[model samples]
Target: MVSTSTTGVLVLLGAPLGNPEDASPRLRTELARADVIAAEDTRRLRRLLSELEVVPGAVITSYFEANEAGKTTALLERLHDGKRVAIITDGGMPSVSDPGFRLVKAAVDAGIPITCAPGASAVTTALALSGMPCDRFCFEGFAPRKDGERRRLFTELAEEKRTMVFFESPRRVTDTLRAMAAVFGDDRPAALCRELTKTHEEVRRGGLAALAEGAEADPPRGEITLVVSGWTGPAASEATPEAMAAAVAALEATGTDRKIAMKTVALRFGVSRRDVYEAVLKAD
Candidate 1:
């Protein structure tokens, strides 16, 4: 067992998504000075350390999805014993669709100090590279693997106004895009980002239908992140007359002519132009 006199602090370091040069100076210090380092993949951690040219002075242990629950106790014990416990994942932030969540929660419950060295995040990286509106967005993590569950989830988010970000396997990328086109409308704008931060990185942008067709022709490989534009159609349910009118106004503000905007919004809400005209008067 490694021994140290340093006060225990649970440090979560954001490991490089792809490039080793992305490792921060603080990450190197923590790795070298830690009493115990919990890594999602010990082999990858070793490789990263070798690449970064930093030999850790800490004992290393594997802590991944399968062993995270089991390793929590040992890590917490080390922390409680006043040993600095540093957590690093294969890539990106810990506990973000990665391991280290249980350890962090345990540390917090035990009143142990918790800190982080923020680094590369595939979610943010993909969003920035997607060329989509990033002002308001939500990360959906990985989609449900099963077709039924995935479809249901997509259906639920059909009216979501915030841009949606999702992580999907390369094998399922084409299928997921096709399914999204079915539920979210074929013309909804979207971007498919694959192999981010790597030499073969590719970002394909277009409407959902077009993207689906492109993915069919050229299958994507490596890590994938998908960004789908939010719903801008007429409010579906519980939409007040005023709300429907406001929706039309919003469309018109986007350089769409008012008559066309009203007609489009009316069709979206499954209502007639006369109904939308009445709602507009009410809004006024």
Candidate 2:
């Protein structure tokens, strides 16, 4: 039972990554005025509310990864009822590797209006602090967890020319760095940004090998963001056929399927599979 003329607005709020002080005044006003607030972590939202000294008149509900799909439908219902709905995550903007993408997509398809209260983001924060080339960069989100998967991912990105940013668990950071070193090269410049925008914030900068060794010697704890300088070596298009064959052999040595390795080499060299196959034939 909803009125067609009373379609509600969906507000996407950007929560502060760590410091409560980073919360914007507009965010506070929106939180207080919202009719329903869907939060990634209700407890964290409460803490934020307490910190902001705002007593929300809205009904707050949990909307995290596990429950996002099931809860989007109910939230959409509220929107149809013309309720001002707000979605906030534990940190940064919702839907950027966060839980709000489903809801946002649903709202869009349902013809509901959507707005955002932009705030601090760890991605840009880490990138800005890294001192790398930020004119052009790509956020790769969190790197794959499995060893082979992680290595393959780094291998694929080996020829990426733009600066890259990634989020990683402190527990796997050292291993991840080692893998990056193996593929991206030991001397590849990178920055390990830990506990960004908070007390005890630290940014370690150097070659991948040094960073990996430092991380191994003293394990870092807290939220971790890694900023890496992209491929500065010779372009893949300029690579010789022998070089392509050697690259494929290197991957094959690491237990990658022969076909998959060939495909990866072809991709890295910006050549077709047939070209790579011919290179392999010449090498043999």
Candidate 3:
């Protein structure tokens, strides 16, 4: 366990993803109070400090996912030495879909004082901007990059009653939007937020199909966040093999090749691709 008298406290500060205005004053105070600053991207941290109009000269080090496992120990050593260690991610909250989780856990286990400098969050931003149910929600970060893995992941959240928020690469936003449309239905309301808080920022609210169609026609080029309305539960008798086969064939018709399309459909059905494929062949 860390000696609190020596270790002091470790603060997890959230940095603004884009807009400098999103940086809370609390974050500024925390950043200034730290003896050492561990940033996900030291260069980005430099940029943020520049924007915040404060020049930080503390001992700064990188702590991203690539080296977080190793860096955790190094940072912990600083904390154990009675230094104030403040950790910051590039955006939102540290460890919220970022790489600060390990360091936070280590500090907690060692009895080091830990606190958060709450600031911007794409999940909450998109949810409120989406006009979806905000009382309860889940943040799924980024969906799996591979199409097959994405299926099983989304399947687990198929019946989630709370609103869902996801982060996606701008390059794959169209494809991901279409996937959401297929599973959640073309008419399920969703919102696509691009370049949030920037000059060209846009938030388009509509059903999944419309967002997918628009994004496909003119792809967006910026950070993308999505807020999807939750399933009210698979409406009566919808989780059937016939429904499964239909989703697959329909996706296939929409220029989706058999393999990737089949996997996505299987997720909607909560079944096996082999089962879905057999049903597909039988239907034919």
Best by lDDT: 2
Candidate 3: regions farther than 4 A off: 1-4, 233-245, 251-283
RMSD of 3: 4.2
* Residues 166-278 of candidate 2: C-alpha lDDT, one tens digit per residue: 99999999988987875665578999999988898999999998999999999999999999999775466556888778777766665667787777766655678898899
In model 2, pairs of residues that clash are none
Candidate 2 TM-score, C-alpha based? 0.84
TM-score for candidate 1, residues paired by index: 0.80
lDDT of candidates 1 onward, in order: 0.84, 0.89, 0.81
**TM-score winner, 1 or 2:** 2
- How many residue pairs clash in model 1? 0
Q: Model 3: per-residue lDDT, tens digit, 171-238?
A: 88988887777666677788998877778988998998899899988888888899998877444366
User: How high a TM-score does candidate 3 get?
Assistant: 0.83
**Any runs in candidate 2 off by more than 4 Å, and if so which?**
1-4, 235-284
Across residues 1-284, which tens digit of lDDT does each residue of candidate 1 receive?
89554558999999998888889999888899899999999999999999988988899999999989999999999997899999999889999989988998898888888999999999989888878789999999998887667766776787788899998888998878877775665678999988777788889999987998998898888888899999877546734687568766755543446676566556557678888889998888
lDDT, candidate 1, at 30:
86
